[model samples]
Structure formats: structure tokens, C-alpha cells
Target: MASSAIKHGELVALQELDSSSPLFKQGASLRVTGKLQEYCVGTAIATIVDGSVSLKIDTQHLRDLNFRVGSIYQFIGELLIQSDTDAVLQARVGRNVDGIDLNLYHQSMHLQRQFEVDYMRTRTT
Candidate 1:
């Protein structure tokens, strides 16, 4: 199938050998796991180029999920698997746990500060 013919959200198997029409086919949702690598924060693009699959991720989403480079994640996301060497991921479901405790602690502190600011603003107004 022509890569252009594939819909934006259409799912295709990452491996060229996969030909199962039912379990693996076009437009089917698939969960893939891969390590995060080759990313550009300025462009908001991250790539997971593996032996069987390749994925592209939005760094903003990664940041929201506290994903870090060199970390592994599971993505239940949309795919445009054009070929064995070409594919794209539009979303993901999981993130890296490296430094997660520290990250969460910082996040909690930030949230507490925001809550305090909001409370003060409301009281003043």
C-alpha cells in the first residue's frame, strides 16, 4: 500500500514480516514498547527507532508524562507504518520511571506553590 494511501491514524505492522489481517492490520490500535532516543526538544519531536518498529513522539506530551531520554515506554498510540524502515507514532500511554520519585516531589512542590498563589489571589480579590 502507498504510504500516502494510509490514513493519518491508520495502524500498520512495524515489521515487514507481519501479515496477520485480524490481529495486525491497517487502522488497528497497537501497543508498542521502545526506548526513547534521538530527540529534539526545540522541535518537540522524539524518535524510537528499533529493530521492528519506529516511532515519533511529541516532547510536550513526554514532558507531561515525565518521560526522559534513554528511557523505555509503552505506547498505545496511532501509527502510520509506511514500511519496515518508516513509521510514525501520534501518541503514547506510558513514561519512564527513572528519577520518578524526585520528579514527583518537585511537581508536588510546584503544585502547592500554585495553589497558594491562587488562594492568595482569590483572598485579595
Candidate 2:
């Protein structure tokens, strides 16, 4: 089985891991919690149920998604903080896990850090 990769500018649910936790470092397995609506670079605008938070991301490989407002999703992606807005996105990796796990994670050390071919749309071999 392969692990999924993450990106930027996507919404997610995060439950930060403790510093003592092994998954405290970058690229750790995180639990899905919620989803985000919009993200920029340095800061991201996200909502959780009836409330929301102004948080930061920890990755770069971003997969742009048009998130719906107040909707909760378990999407997994890289976390990024930009000058304008923060982002959670799908990143490229050696292992093959669909970037669209549509899941989320935690472990905010606060240190963090897509493309298409339709068929370039026709060969699944």
C-alpha cells in the first residue's frame, strides 16, 4: 500500500500532534478533521462547523480546489503560508497515493514548507 501525497490551497481538518509525538515532524500521518474554503501564502481562511480559524500551512505542493463554504471535508494536502493567503494542497511524491484522498491531518510545527493530462487522457496501463 502507498501513502497519499499532499498539496496546497485545499481545506482540511487538523489535530496538531504533540512535540513528543513521533509524527510531530513534517510529513507525518495526520487525522482528518475539517476542510478549508480558501488559502493564500502566509495565512489561510478556514472554517470549522459553526466557528473558524486563521491558521498556517506546512507544505508547498498545492492542488488548487474550489472549496465550499462551511463544508467539512477530510482532504489531505500540503500546508503553505504565503504573503497573501495560506494554502493546503496536494504535493508530488515518489510513492503513489492519490493526492485527492480528500482527507486531513495535524502536526503543526509551524515550520512547513499539479498538473493534468486528460488522456494525454487515454491510457491506464
Candidate 3:
């Protein structure tokens, strides 16, 4: 049966392994989930997942979240965990989210310095 969750360091298949042939032979899809968690570097979302929290990520560019959440999103990119026992969703790419305990939220970290940053912060602070 297909699992509905992922763990901190476990590996899950976000995309079909049979698809990426030859050059891009990434081990069973890609370990983007764990790597992304590492990539964030001390981000709360990743930390939460490690602690069995829930999370989500904006994957419009990933061609996944553009469709659905959870089960549907699983087909887009990749979900990973260190082991099968851990009940945490590690979405490598998607909007809705799943697996890990924490909701792995993901938004485009746009360096929108040119998109009017000062005006927005000034109003909030």
C-alpha cells in the first residue's frame, strides 16, 4: 500500500522513478525533500517537520501543486523521510502539503527588493 506520510531523513518518491531516464537518474526521483530541509538552514518549517510537524510548499513552478494536494501532489516532485516509521510529510514541491508532522510551508523567497518592500514593512511594523 502507498504510504500517506514521510519522515525527516527517509526517502519518498515524489515523481515516478521510471520516468527520469538516463542523464537525470536521480536516486528514486530526487532527495529534494531532505536536501530542501537542509537547504533552508535553520528554518522553522523544516525544524517543525523534524519534530513531526506538518508543512506545505509553493510548487507552481514544480508543476505539482498546480493540480491538487496530498495524494495528487505526490506525483509532481518527491516526498522523503529517513525511515518508513516516521509519520511526517516532507513535500519536495507542492502547495497543499503532507507527510511530516509539521506543515512544511513553502513560498517563493523572492528578492523582491524591486517590488516595493519598504512600503509593505512600514505599514505592518
Highest lDDT scorer: 1
Report, for every candidate in turn, its global Cα lDDT versus the true structure.
Answer: 0.54, 0.36, 0.32
Candidate 3 achieves a global lDDT of: 0.32
The digit string of per-residue lDDT tens for model 3 on 19-56 reads: 23231332233332322332232342331122232233
Query: Candidate 3 — which residues are off by over 4 angstroms?
Result: 1-53, 75-125
Give the per-residue lDDT digits (tens) of candidate 2, residues 1-125: 88564433232334432344343444443433443444455543333221344333332443454445444444344433233333333333212123333222233322221113434344553
Error of 3 at 98 (Å): 13
Provide the TM-score for each candidate, comma-separated.
0.45, 0.32, 0.19
Query: To one decimal, what is the Cα RMSD in angstroms of model 1 from the true structure?
Result: 14.7
Per-residue accuracy of model 1 over 16-110 as CA lDDT, tens digit each? 31544443444445654556777776876677634545567644544366556777655565555666544455564555544334334445656
Better of 1 and 3 by lDDT: 1
Q: After superposition, how far is residue 53 of candidate 2 from its true place, in Å?
A: 8.3
Better of 2 and 3 by lDDT: 2
Stretches of candidate 2 off by over 4 Å are 1-13, 41-55, 58-64, 77-125
